[model samples]
Target: MRAVITTEAGGPEVLTLDDVPTPEPKPGQLLIAVVAAGVNRADILQRQGHYPPPPGESDIIGLEVSGYVSAIGAGVTGWRVGERCVALLAGGGYAEYVAVNAGQVTRPPEGIDLVEAAGILEVAATVVSNLDAVRFKAGETFLVHGGTGGIGMFAIQYAKARGATVLTTAGTPEKLDLCRTLGADTALDYHDDWVDGVKEATGGRGVDVILDNMGAKYLTPNVRSLARLGRLVVIGLQGGVKGELNLNTLLGKCATVTATSLRFRPADEKAAIVSRVSDEVWPLIASGRIAIAHQTRFPVDDVRAAHQQLTGGNHVGKVVLTF
Candidate 1:
């Protein structure tokens, strides 16, 4: 098997396609023959030495993939060899084959091609878990940052499909338009006074739920951007990690702040989230209420180019690497 490995973490140039031993399915896992893999900002961070794979996981840089089940491990039932599936992986997706927990794999919805489904698992799991934590309700307001990115694009459509009024921020005008087309009620320029824009859009009440990726850079304003009893779920730290929080503001609004990561979670927890997403989110995808977008595709051998496209920040949806 050929997998993308980093010689030393620094830039996309470090990514190399090298022959590596094929991974075998562990108990309750499935060995998938990769058809396509999704590229994420996390992969870039890992390549640059900023983020490492979780303990006991593969060192390869990928988080989601769509493929055919080539083999199944002991204790796994109901899934068969040659079944088309997509999976949320901890790592090792940048390869010809990957072993993932059976509970974390899902069959692509009817009418969705495997290549597009490659980008669905990570975004679906992330958005579903965070929205579940916030107790998102129909008719409530939801705000998501980085509207053009994979997670943000899915978050906007998923929230809208659940009946929320979705607002999102994007860096470019074209991206903002794409967000609106994807069902966001409003899309604001991230480089401008986005907080003020969001507040104004909601008649100064702020939003009921926020899916934030900027971490410390938006912490204070995120607090201010919340309505009473609002919830802020932070999943990324594109900004610096450390930031001051005003306890008084949170107390006054009865708001809550939470930070979470998907890759480092326990196996059972990941299984639970995957199950919930399959039950709730997959139907919307099948019905076309929620759509998966693939902005670009590269061959597996061109993994470095895939990483560069993601880091360049100009792509409007998920960048996929084809096997």
Candidate 2:
């Protein structure tokens, strides 16, 4: 099997293409002939040696994959060899094949191409789990930072599907337009006074929920933009990690602040997240209520270029590498 091996902890330049042994499924996993794999920020961080795979997991670099099951472990059921599916993985997605846990696998929605399916699991699971954390309700307004990216686009669509009014912040007009196309009722320019824009849009009432990636950079404004009992869920810290949080502000609005990362979660927790996303969000894809926004595709050998695209901050959706 051919794979993009991380020869060392460095830039994308370190990714090397090589023929590696095909990985066989363990007792509780499925060996998938890889079609495509989602490129995530975590993948880039891992390449730089900042994030390592969990204990006993593959040292290879992908977090999610979409392909057909080529072999199944002895105890796996409800799926069979040759079944088209997408799955979350502990690691090893940057290859021609990946062994995925049966419990974390989801049948590809009908009509979704394999490349597009590759963009689903990670973003879907992330958005759904964070949305769950906030207990988002229909008719409520939710604000998402980084609205044109994979997770943001997923959150925008899912929130809209549930009848929530969605708003988002993006640094470019192109990105903001993409967010609007994805169902955000309003898309503010993150480069500007986003808080004022959001406040004006809600007639000074603020939003019920905020999905933020910039973290500390948006912390103060995020606090000021929340309505009573609002929930702010932070999933990325692309800005800065530490900030003087205003507890009084939070208390005054009776809001809540929470943060999470999907890659570091335990297996059972990941399995449960996958199950819930498959059960609740998969139907939307099948029915066209939700769609995968796959913006770019690079061959497995050009993973370095893929990483460059992500780091360039020019992509509007999920970037994928195909086998």
Candidate 3:
């Protein structure tokens, strides 16, 4: 099997296609013949040696994929050979084949292309699981930084579908417009004082909830932008890991701050999240309430180009590697 292998921690140039032994299904797992794999910022981090797969998992760079079940392992039932499915994985997606626990697999939403389904699980699982954990309400205002990225775009639409007023941040006008098309009520340019824009959009009341990926860079402003008793969930640290926070402002607003990483969770926990998405969110997708996100494809052999494109931050929505 052909898989993208990194020679060392560095740039996209380090990623090379190499022949590797095919993964076999273990007990209660499935051997998937991967059709496509979703590229993520985490992959870049792993390539740069900032992130690594959980112990005992594959060292492959991908986190999600759409593929067909080639073999079902012992104790796995209700799945047959050759069923089209998508999976959320701890690792091992950037390859021609991957072995995933059966619990992490679900049928892609009807009418969605199998190839594009590669882009679905990671974004959907991240947004849905986090929102559910935070108990985000329908009438509450929601803001997500990096609105053009895969998770951000999905968060915008999913929040809107659940009846929340959605706001997002992007660096470009075209990106902002795309967010609006996907149902963002307000799209603020991150290059500006977007915290002030958040305040202005909410008429100074601040938002009821925020889904931020900027971590420490936005911590203080995110706290300042919260409405009374608002909740802020940090799921990434793209802007840096450490920042000062004003406890007084957070105290005054009676807000709560929490952080999570979907990629580092245990398999059973991932299975639970996968189940929640399949039961609750998949309906939204199948009903077209959650729009099919913008997708960009790169051939698997050109995985280096795919990494470069994602790292360049010029593409909207998710980037996928086709097999």
Candidate 4:
């Protein structure tokens, strides 16, 4: 099997396609013949030595994949060889084959091809998990930062589908238009006073739920932009790690803040999330209420190019690597 191997932690140039032993399924796992893999910011961070794979997981740099089951290990039932499925992986997706726990595999939504399905699991799981944690309800206002990215785009569609009035922030006009087309009620320029814009869009009540990716950079402003009893869910730290919080403001608004990550969770927890997404979110996808957006596809051998595209920050949605 040929896999993307990093010679050292640095730039995209370090990623090279090399022959490696094909992974075999372990108990209760499935060996998938990789068809396509989703490129994520986590992969770039891993390549730069900022993020490493979780303990006991593969060192390869991918978090989600779509493919066919080539084999299944003991204790795995109800799934067969040749079944088309997508998986939320902890690692090892940048390869010709990957071994994943059977519980993490899900059937692609009806009418979606395997290549596009590669981008579904990670974004869907991330958005759904955070929204569930915040107890996001219909008829509330939802705001998502980085609205043009994979998770951001899906978050907009998901929130709208659930009956929330959605607002999003993007750096470019093209991205803002795309967000509106995807159902965001308002799209604000991230480089401007987005906090003020969010409040205005919500009729000065502020947003009830916020899906934030810019951690420390937006912490204070995020607090300011929340309505009473609002919830802020932080999932990325592109801005920075440490920031001061205004306890007084939070108390006044009765707001809550939560930070979460999906890759390092326990197996059973990941299984639960995967199961919920398959059951609840898949139907939304099948009905076309939520859609998969693919900005570009690069061959597996050109993994470096894929990484570059993601880091360049110009792509509107997911950058997929095809086998």
TM-score of each: 0.97, 0.96, 0.98, 0.98
lDDT of 1: 0.91
Better of 3 and 4 by lDDT: 4
Quantify all predictions' global Cα lDDT against the true fold: 0.91, 0.89, 0.91, 0.92
Q: What are the per-residue Cα lDDT tens digits for candidate 3 across 1-323? A: 99999879999999999999998899999999999999998999999999989899999889999999999999999999999999999999999999999999999988888987999999899998899888997899999999989999889989999899999999889998999989999999989999899889999999998998889989999999899999999998888999998998988989999999998888898999999888887889889888877888999988988888887868788899999
* Residue range with the least summed lDDT across 10 consecutive positions in model 2: 236-245
C-alpha positional error of residue 235 in candidate 2 after TM-score superposition, expressed in Å = 0.7
lDDT of 1 by residue, 133-152 (tens): 77888999999999888998
Query: How well does candidate 1 match the true structure in TM-score terms?
Result: 0.97
N/CA/C clash count, model 3: 0
Residue 108 CA displacement from its true place in model 1, Å: 1.1
Query: Which ranking of candidates, highest lDDT first?
Result: 4, 3, 1, 2
Error of 2 at 71 (Å): 1.4
- Enumerate residue pairs that collide in model 2: none
Decide which is better by TM-score, 2 or 3: 3
TM-score of 4: 0.98
Model 2, C-alpha of 236: deviation from truth (Å): 1.0
Which ranges in model 4 have alpha carbons more than 4 Å from their true place? none
